[model samples]
Target: WKSLIRVVVSGAAGMISNHLLFKLASGEVFGPDQPIALRLLGSERSYQALEGVAMELEDSLYPLLREVSIGVNPYDVFEDAEWALLVGAKPRGPGMERAALLDINGQIFAEQGKALNAVASRSVKVMVVGNPCNTNALICLKNAPNIPAKNFHALTRLDENRAKCQLALKAGVFYDKVSNVTIWGNHSTTQVPDFVNAKINGVPVKKVITDTKWLEQEFTERVQKRGGVLIQKWGRSSAASTAVSIVDGIRSLITPTPEGDWFSSGVYTNGNPYGIAEDIVFSMPCRSKGDGDYELVKDVVIDDFLRERLKKTEAELIAEKRCVAHLTGE
Candidate 1:
């Protein structure tokens, strides 16, 4: 068995983490043979709830869970952390402006970044799950100058999974039949779910579905706005499915990609071949070799339609970065 892997989770008392913590304790993410120590980070308002969460973990009696720690300070909980899941952020209230929300969450990530830089493992893998995540991730990596920019990621796996499900349902196939459904650019409604490159049962999606109009219009809109649609139906943002996507996101990094398959993730865009702006976290197709290292999937054919969509989403991300520029030290 491998040694204990230390994980730090921010927003540990929230809905997403509420579902995610138990999965981590059960060794679903890092494998059952690998023991894990979880450090849960929360704010003062959520400390008591965090303790309740710890009590639940104890009751679960997971064999691979070696230790659990809860605290309000990131510095105290993040020490030597190997995996940091940043799932906490200020949600936009009824009257809150988008820029105001960005500034508030940007401050939170900036502090957490400094704390992680000071105490966490030099090679710690950071996944930003907070809202405006791509920009928040950029702010985080900028603050933690010592950590490699490639080590930071923003969650876009949920969007990828959503796109796949849409394709599968339209084609009357299992979800697993869809491949290469990359989410380009931001995680917001501006996100472009690239069905052009997607394949169904090893065939191009357009050829199988025979509804290029739907794929170009309704299909893209569905994936981009699925979160809001869910909230309208459920009265809350996604939690369980979001947790599953997080597992998939981490697993994709640790496991080798199939010979011709790639997964989508929001990663640093420096030197990317897609003409994306550098120094920003953007979602793109990537492949890994099971060594916790990944490279962008080059050679994706972007036609005029996909290129225009990419430019739109990229503009949104660039605008978001500008909104948090002061926090990012730009």
Candidate 2:
């Protein structure tokens, strides 16, 4: 048996976790050579559902899955974990204000941050997948003063992957042929998917598609709104695709992509060239080597239009940060 790696997945009983757990158990996220001990954390109210899911996972009898444990408390689940996925949050239901949603998630993440600080292993890496994930990640980072800031990342790879799929479809190229796609700013509607420097088969994407007007109109909007489109088509929110992106994000983190090729992720900005304020969590093209540090991609051309969009998205993130600060009195 391979050595066991403890993986803590918060919000273990939620819809997204339901979709993600099977892949993790089957050794799709972590390599097959590694044994996994899944540590699940959920709210007390969802403990029964988590147990049921654990029972199902047990029946699968995955060779690499050495153990599965469930807990209602974050500290218990985080104990000695090597990786922690902060997937649980206060999801918005019908007729909820943005502020209300952020407030609820901030409280949840604050508590989780303390728990992570207390019990997660010294080298634990965390990825926050909850909605408003960037700021929620910020809350966790601020509270977990013990952990390195770079070790706590938020999920923006989902948006980046969506952009790649859509771009590939439009360019009549295979998805693997596309590279250098970037998702900047927040993870919401305002998130900027930079295709300016992207390529198909190593040729600049602009050379393939000359319709600047159409590029400005359709491509950008489609990538930004793909989640809503998926919801419209499926009559529910995206789970499978989101789960796949999470896997990809983690994989990229563990196995660094080659130089000159990078993926988008929510990373800490010390007010870098992108004009993002100091320490704010925002998505940028980043390269990692599985050591938990993400270096930002710099000097890519940002046209006037792209700059405006980036500003707009950054504004949204700033507003979110302030709103959460107000609620939590931070």
Candidate 3:
């Protein structure tokens, strides 16, 4: 094994983490030679399911899996953790309001924030994957002042992947051939899938495909509501793809960005490319150095269309921050 580090995964019994755990154990996020010590966190009601997951993990007998621990206590689960995948939060059900959902999860993430601040490794990196993740990341980041803001992130890489796939399909190219796709602002429907800067096999996307109608309307809406579209077609929300996106997000953090290409991630607006309000966890085109650190890619072309869309997502995040204003004490 290349290295051994403790990783705490929240919502260990949930669907996303159920797939994520295996990926982590198999060294998909890290490297094949790396061993990981996994600490699974769940709600009290999910303890039995967590145990069954642990049992299956043991049955799989992954060589890179050094050790496994399960608990419902955040304090216990977060202790000595180097990486925390905060995936557990109240999923939005039928007729549920965003404000109500945030309030419920506010308490959960607030407690976790405290536990992470109190006991986790000083360099611990936290990735928020639960719903309302951008704001939820803000809550956790606000609650942990000791850790650097850059240490916390929300998963917008899913949107980035979705945008790349959509563009690739429209361009009649493979997804791997798509690069420089950015998911700007919130991970919600207001997100901007920037095809303006996207490239398919080193050719400018716009130069290759000249359907302005498709790019302006269909591309925008499809990337924004792809999650809902999937649910309508499959009778479920995204799970496997979400899991893959999580792996891509983490890998982007731990691996250096490819030359001339960047990935998108939800990050604090401190010294960002945009002039958006500070303290909003916004997604920006980013380059990583494989050191658990990232730098925003700046000075990209932003026409009126892109600018307007960015503002809308910014406004949505601002309103979301206001809804949880009580939690942030701002």
Candidate 4:
């Protein structure tokens, strides 16, 4: 029998997890030779749904899946976890302001952070997928004083993937032909989908597309707001794509990056070359060596326009940090 890699997933009954759980169990994120023990976390109100989800996992009989446990409390579910996927949070209600949503989720992450610090593996890699994920990840890391902040990540691979797709379609090439697309700053509308550094078919995107106006305006806006566009067309938030991005995000961390290529993730901004604010979770170009470690890609050219866009997203993240100051102890 293969050794078990303990993984804790919060919001286990949500739409995103509905898709993600199967992928994890199928060894799509981790390798086929590795086995995993899933510890599922959910709210008391969602316990039955969580049970049903577990039942389905049991029915599927994935070869790489070894053990499964379900609970409503993070403290109970987080023990010895090597990977924590914080995918659940209260959604923005009809009249709820963004600040209010941050505060509510801030409390949730703060408590979970403490739980993780107390029980999870010291080297656990956490991926925060909850909305306002950049700020939520910051809050989570801040509250977990014992855990290194670098272990926490906000999901921005979706934006990076979106940017690559846009560039591919505009250049009339396949999506895989596009590379080096970096998502800078928070995971919000203000996030910068940096076409300046992206390439198509091993050539700079600007050199191929040749439409400065569309690249600067249409391409960036489309990537940044692609989530909203999907919701508008589908009448529901993106679930399957979001799940796939989570897999991609985690895979990027564990797999060695291709030479001359980098992926985007929301990482701690301290020591970052681009002068993003310290102690905040901001997305940037990153490369990994398949050892569950990554470093920020340095010396990427950030033109004046991209610099200004980065500043806007940084300011928004700073304001969000201040809004959750009480929870984060900022």
Best by lDDT: 1
**By TM-score, is 3 or 4 better?**
4
Query: What tens digits encode model 4's per-residue C-alpha lDDT throughout 207-291?
Result: 9999999999998899888998898899888999999999999999999999999999999999988888888899999999987
**Model 2 Cα lDDT, one tens digit per residue, 1-330:** 667999998888988899899999999888889899998898888889999989999999998889999998887889988899888887688899998899888889988888888988877888999988999989888888888888888899989888888778888988998999889888889999888878778888888878777677888898889888888898877888878888999898888778779988997776577776776788888888765566777867788888889889888988898888853347
- In what order do the candidates fall by lDDT, top score first? 1, 4, 3, 2
Q: lDDT of each model, Cα atoms only?
A: 0.93, 0.86, 0.90, 0.92
lDDT (Cα) of model 3? 0.90
Which runs of model 3 end up more than 4 angstroms from their true locations?
none
Which portions of model 1 show Cα errors greater than 4 Å? none
On residues 1-330, what C-alpha lDDT tens digit does candidate 3 reach at each position?
A: 466889999999998888999999998788888899999999889899999999989889999999999999999999989999999988887899989998999878888988999999989999999979999999998988888889999999999989988888898888899999989999899999998988889888888889988988999899999999999999988888999999999999899899999999999998775677787999889899999898989867888899998999999999999999988868
**Number of colliding residue pairs in each model:** 0, 0, 1, 0
Clashing pairs in 3: 2-33
List candidate 2 stretches off by more than 4 Å.
326-329
For candidate 4, the clash count comes to 0
Ranking by TM-score: 1, 4, 3, 2
Candidate 1 structure lDDT: 0.93
TM-score-better candidate, 2 vs 3: 3
241-325 per-residue lDDT for model 1 (tens digits): 9999999999999999998989999999999999999988999999999888899999788999999999999999889888998
Off by over 4 Å in 4: none
